[model samples]
Target: MRTWRLVRVVTLLLLAVSYCEFFHYYMVLLLCTWPSVSSVQGFQSHPLRAMFIGDTHILGSNAHWFDKLRREWMMTRSFQASMLIHSPDVVFVLGDLMDYGTESSSTEFEYHVQRFKRMFSTPFTTRTEIIVGNHDIGFHHMINDKRYERFKEAFSAPSVRLISVKDVIFVMVNSMALHGDGCSFCKEAEDALKNIKWQLKCSKGKLDQEKVAEICEKLDIMNYSRPILLQHFPLYRTSDSNCSTPDAAPLEEIDIPFRIKTDCLSKESTDLLFELLNPRLVVSAHTHHGCYRLHDNGIPEYTVASYNWRNKHNPTFFLAELTDQDFIINRCSLPDEHTVFTLYAIFAILLVIVIIIPPKKQKPNLGKSFTPSNKDH
Candidate 1:
């Protein structure tokens, strides 16, 4: 009987340890319920619930097996739980889809894609949009036709394009091409942006349809709204010195001056985007930290933190309730890595103690048994 009791106790303890190790993700989701969105008067009855994930940086050749498995599991659990709980209308993955993306061969890239798909699989109704990051292809100096072609083939990533959800328009750009250097890649990106500008102008009744007959036939330009600019790099900024957000870049990096076209888009590139797109808001991710900057023109730009635990202990993403005229963005953090691991460690310790310690033996039926025997005699 003691043996059976010990077996059951050990089994339950093991299950407890397992829950702390894996199933704790769901608990985090239950605890961090999606932020409530304020209803705007002019907005539709239901605003678009858009989920924005920051740089995932899924590892490639550099990852150890255990590290790769652990990170992927965490991401998969968080993503799955978020989808199940939030039921977002759209998911925007804000670049850096893979670490060493530029270094991966075709086969390696395919494997990475498969892994990403497995972790981030969504329902058919939930649309996903991905932006191009420097890591996915390369920095301006390292970008080439071959690398660009591979990424484009895998993701269908155009240099710049426009996406419309409900009445909201999102102008997604390949920020890496905003180097301002007139390379072949840059020229193509520049041309695409110019085309988007013309389209926007046409939508606002500033351009004659007769002059651009080709583009006019492609869509009902009059129906489009002012765009929300989406890109991989933040606009020109000196540094994060002025950012006061809790998730802003580390204190050590706060005062470090940013390099134009390295840490952020060049001044000229930023100006061109603002002049052309006339965006209502801007969203970017690359620094793996959160930042909120109100540009000089009064436009708000939000830099989302990384979604992968490998990047930080407290990974985070954005939840934006969007409309044609207004938006509400809430920064939601994933389960803390340290907390999750600590919980698992504690449970594991309890499990080890349970297995090591013997179950207490029943202390004496001594007097009772003797009395029964004497009465029978």
Candidate 2:
């Protein structure tokens, strides 16, 4: 009886844990899908609204089952986001366009892009740009100039590009640059970063200005209201400080350890970039979980969740409305119908198998061991 009771208790505990997982994400979806009552009535589309996606990791032929699952789930979730109210005018694909991006994989890459395009449901209407990711360049967690060039040929996108939405600037940086030393692409990225400073010089007043006569006069050169930095890896896992430990797990996904582990970005370079360009917002995706916090400078930095991750119950994307007053960012979950169904089905099956089955009865003795006998004593 005691053993049966323990078994039941264990099953109940397991069920509770699973329920919390589903409930947490479902609630997130519900909350994000609906706008507040005031916004529903008064809200109109902003002039330059944008949608941001996390790492896609689009898989190709002869890939593992998980990769295939990731691809399909991401497509469904992305489609759902696009269909929602206040849909984006421009969609920014941060990076990781392919599982292991290469010119040789161009066919697979193009196919994924087309599928993604269809999913977004804005093939021709909405403008979209993809930046280079570490995988896109096949740099072994670093940047390879040759592969970077080939990635451009494969996709016809620059390694680093600047996008403008009204007065807001989205600077896409090639995160592969800081993956290793002696990277030629790093130099190219530097020049690109330099150009960004010049372009956003007039927007500096928005960060902190008394709006004095001199500052107001300089506003003529205002080509941007604020700058948003987009990249693959987070600058530091948090808004402040650096995170680089060789002993830390290799940042690669599901691969047997073979290469020397290194931090996602070099502390030196990240510090320099931060010093040179203190962006109004920083968004990135590499870790499969999502995070939103403010940098030491009070700038918002978001580490987005991967759509391909099943464990990350709340697969998320971002929506931004660049209003005159400020930029409002909302994180929305990508609802995966199939996964949700599978989870519930498994839970139900476990309950029936464990709780519905009865334990076998054992012989009972009254204060003494009972021997098999021909007749009862």
Candidate 3:
């Protein structure tokens, strides 16, 4: 009888253990999976407003804190929805949509896609454009692989496309080649640019002295106003190697891979490219640090902070409100501890189920024996 009681206890304990495991697994999956919605509202009018968000690095397999950060992001759906409610004509995501290229999968990537879809949905169907970032290109390892192919396949279409919006001719440049493992695409890009330049001239467009000038000339001929260049890397001095500022310490600056480099259009090749492009406003994000500056030539370049674990302190986004005459730039900081606490509370509940519930279930079956004592009396 005692043996049977022991077996019963063991069975209950096993069931409790199984239940805990299943619950934890399901919660984790829920945390990682893409969110779904019934419907997306459309914008009511045309020529609406627009905003720019950059570097949302939403991938990691590390500590619970990472999941907490992700949950915080998940909660921002309402915040983003409010922006759409204000009727932004378009939304520009600068770069670094995902943290690791190697970690890209159908399921994982879909999670990111769904997140963006939820945040950027509109009533009148606002357009959302995404530019390729360094992480999107696989950093240093194999360049232009399945992940890249998948990204292009997913976002290269007309819906989530690359095109000029209104007066701002947005050019989504793939800047990963500068730090990619090979030089194949780098050469190919250079060749493509040369061909594009020729095509512009053939179309009766005069070439400018600088690369920016040529690009602007071509865009101008196409009826595009001042071009706003969007790339993954900053065009200005991101490092203090050339200039000095009290706030410009090496540690204080964003430390990207050593393979990648940045300069303010004076590094010969890159300088020529920027000078020719002569973009009115250049927006980029890769260093995960945020900065906004105006060059001597009156061009403004802004770097957006990342929405990832690395940039927890400044987990914010840039909002560019464009009018007919000019645009206003605003930095909106994401929600901090309130959202984080909700996630922690969820994990804490799971921890209790996993560690406490099973042991309590196995505590001897004393109630069963006591019930039968009535017959003996």
Candidate 4:
């Protein structure tokens, strides 16, 4: 009986440990990332106050407005608190501004994009950059130039554009064009890369060659000014090359497609780009999973968790405090519903255990019956 009791104790301990780990993540979702609690405005002197959210996949319509409204409302509050405190200048959406790049016409898609813009216009106040993802261009499919052009114009951005603010320059690139598989916009993408390289080399800390490079002088760019590279894909799954990894993680199948594996960036191109670009920081969205890790070369890279709750993964995003040359990444995505649901699950299992196992009844009846002689009954 003692041995059985010891086994039971050990089992309980193991379960407790497992639950403790689960509880930690649950609390983070409930407290740190939950949108109900509006964010505190950050300091004003912050260089660039921006929120980075990924893969909204918002199904914008009357039927789903409630969910959309609540999520964005919470996000706005969070953004405001970030601004009130961190003082971000804008929002950088990693990509997939539309829900139906797969089927919707360019005009329809553009309308949706504009709607998205208007939705955030009130809260965002400043500029909000919407990067294009595979979903925006049809995942793993060649992009239609006509559609991509319309999308770009609607957003009033180039295939690759640069934004300069407070000694920081943000370079946005369309990775769909960079696939190097004879994509329609491949030439434009190649040109964009060349332009970026030239701008960085000749302009030296200035977005325009004509403007004086005060930022370069102030930040001492003669040495090396690491620019922030934004895109929709990652270079590597595990290694720390400044390139992107696949948009999706490796599946459990025996064989996967070559294109799928290198869908984000080919190893050869990744290596060349790293040598040419030398991006100090890499930010991307594709994988719903949230990640922050340094490249093998030491540049920090991140994949913000998807904002949409429709995915199998938990909703996640990050509070990026862009410190001078590096980034202070604070992940805030795991949400209230997830926590509540997890808690309920754990409780349900425990309740079932209680219900299923009968309680230990006192063995008193047997003792009394056996002790009849002592009672002299």
Index of the highest-lDDT prediction: 1
Give the whole-model CA lDDT for all candidates, comma-separated. Answer: 0.84, 0.61, 0.53, 0.60
lDDT of 2 by residue, 139-163 (tens): 5444455666666765567756666
What TM-score does candidate 1 get on C-alpha atoms?
0.90
Q: State the lDDT at 330 in candidate 1.
A: 84
Q: What TM-score do all the candidates reach, one by one?
A: 0.90, 0.64, 0.60, 0.64
The per-residue C-alpha lDDT of model 1 at residue 226 equals: 72
The whole-model C-alpha lDDT of candidate 1 against the native structure comes to 0.84
- For model 4, residues 1-377, the per-residue Cα lDDT tens digits are 45555565567656755554344444454454211221233443454555788777655444377766656554444344444444346778888765666566656676677667655553445667778877776654556667677767777666677666655677787766666665557767777676666566654544654544533333323323557888877665533222233322334421333253334566655665676677888888776655566767887778776766554345656666553354555666444456545765776676567555655665555443343366554
Task: Tell me how many clashing residue pairs each candidate has.
Answer: 0, 1, 16, 22
Candidate 3's TM-score: 0.60
Query: lDDT of candidate 4 vs native?
Result: 0.60
Name the runs in model 2 displaced over 4 angstroms: 1-47, 64-74, 77-81, 84-86, 102-116, 119-123, 140-146, 153-156, 179-182, 202-222, 238-263, 336-339, 342-377
Whole-model lDDT, model 3: 0.53
